[model samples]
Target: MKRINTLGAGCLARALAFSLAAGGLALPLSAQAADLPAAVAQDLYENGGVEHWLPKAEKGDIFAQYVLGHMYCNGKKVEKNYELGMRWYRKAADAGFAPSQLAVGTMYFQGQGVERDRDEALDWFTRAAEEGYARAQSNLAALYLGEKGVEPDYEKALHWYGKAAAQGHTVARYNLGMMYAHGLGLDEPDYVAAYGLLSPLVENGHRAADELMQSFLGEMDEEELVAARELSEELQAQDRMLVALDQRAANR
Candidate 1:
């Protein structure tokens, strides 16, 4: 599994959570935290499948517009068409949909539907991120990490990651754990802190987080290892509680 920059799963998790929460949809939190694909598929079906929404997208229903853009961008129930995807994304973004803004910015950065323009992407990402879009916050963290269109700024990366991580974005947690483990930003490596941040994801079978935790834990003393294990157990227990609460809520 790719250790670095494999934050797509984490990003998706936060985005869906924020979207669903904002829309007041009841999420069955028993759903695996790391299962982005299943969550997204369920979301799409619930929001009205591609057929019911695609025509609305053409007519500029902002949510439908964004979903249609994503569908074409990622070939969900439709042939991938970057140009059409960008067109739809831009329409929604221009109408002030934060998610669409981030999507358009990502396409620009990756040259998916437009020419690669890191600077332009950064500008758009900043706007969405500042408005508290978790995906934008995570992507902005990456830009800071990579020093795109600016100097390398570990502090900025940490700041943005903290924002996303607060919303339970796993990759942000992973990156913050790495920062703690590597003694970045003049802070000493703190395995206990890293473990606390990563344990939930690791318990959820996040491959990269698990690998990184093992490697990082190898450097800690036995006492630290014990502490880490205890922290992990607590996180797992918390996850179970969250699941139980979801079930209870559903029954109510």
Candidate 2:
């Protein structure tokens, strides 16, 4: 698939490029603390209390290590130290923490504390994606589509995008919808599938998806429009069920 940069450019290329830029691959300090205890996590954000997490981080608490890494990276309570942040991230990642793995991958991709290494970033992203981290799956899809280092692989991109989209990742769903709408890397366009994917995105106030949906409807026939609406309803119901299942799993 060809890549284009402009927002109003060719359908598929523009959508894919927009996704690459808009979907930030990095995990911010707050996102890094998502797996931590709710009370402690909130306190860290509200008070910037790195001291509370430092001892636990030193004691090899995986979540604490990730939090310290985030704090150091953002200079929350400690001086900004990318190297120290990477060190803590690595400790947690080495223990198979998916979020820390994603953080390390982001650092490599952005050259935050180390040299930019797209290959290494891809490796770490693959690790986290395999562990069922939706963000990593989305990032991996972007990298595959963008051809950061390796040759562009639309098939691999679609696979990762589908995995992330199935987990209700908005960006991935938007990208997948665009791909289907324009027949990007496909033998034929699948407007019904595209409409189904984009419907929820438009409802969620995604301007790009809304614009695309308007364009799509202008081109679709009455019969196709009716089918698309039915398909969209089905997809939304399935998505809700998956979300409920995930919540139940998290509670357990």
Candidate 3:
């Protein structure tokens, strides 16, 4: 159903951008070594624990390099050194660690360790996204949506967002829902699709999703509401099946 000029000026786009940015997805980390207790490592990390991991990082341990980079970037176990952070992140990224690639992309995006280069950020994010990293996919979508230093491209944004959303990325789900709700770049709004995308988020206590759901419900008539509810159930079932399939594939 197309609702012409129903949304306030830039309202939907701004909401989508704010929700994505506010989600605050953390940088991914590799699993801790089975031999090394998580508590001990956490204690070390919080209390200048870089000494234990520095040797390993120097010896080309990707996990150690990532940890060291994170510590350096946040000044946890060492003085804040964005250059060293970038160096360590790059080492892991070059070794094909998806998390480190995402981190490096973020560094480039924020000008933390190097010049702020949107192109560099795009490159790193693309590498990680190609490897099926959901955060990187979402970030790449955001970049294409013009949240970073790039012109907005709705088609590219939708492609990347769909990838991330299929992987259960919360921010990407919210964004994709809003895009459907407002027909941001599409010829017509799809309220049923928006409902399907957003219903689970509202159930899970996402404030933004809840607000958007309220707005959506307020705008629809009884017939549309019934149709949206039915569509939402179908979408949820499909999502469950996909997750099950992914789990089975991972176990193989």
Q: Give the number of the best model, judged by TM-score.
A: 2
lDDT of 2 by residue, 1-252 (tens): 232222244655557643222212344666655555799777766654576888888899987888788778877778889999899988998899887888888888779889988888778889988988877788788777764556677778877877888888788888877766766556556677778889998998999898887776766788878977877876776456335323422543
Model 1, span 77-105: residue lDDT tens: 78879898788888888888777777777
For each candidate, what TM-score against the reference?
A: 0.62, 0.81, 0.79
Give the best candidate by lDDT.
Answer: 2
lDDT of 3: 0.71
Candidates 1 and 2 compared by TM-score, better number: 2
Q: Poorest 10 consecutive residues of model 1 by lDDT?
A: 17-26
**Better candidate by lDDT, 2 or 3:** 2
lDDT of 3 by residue, 1-252 (tens): 447536664766566553222211232232322223688556544544677888988999987887788778867647889999899989999999887887888788778889998788789989988988877788788777777458888777777777888877788888877876776656666666678778988998988887777776777888878877766675575356335323422543
TM-score of 2: 0.81
What's the true lDDT of residue 126 in model 1?
80
Reference-based lDDT, each prediction: 0.63, 0.73, 0.71
Candidate 1: count of backbone clashes, pairs at least 3 residues apart or interchain: 0
Off by over 4 Å in 3: 17-48, 221-223, 237-252
Question: How many pairs of residues collide in each model?
Answer: 0, 0, 0
Each prediction's RMSD over C-alphas, in Å, is 10.9, 6.7, 6.2
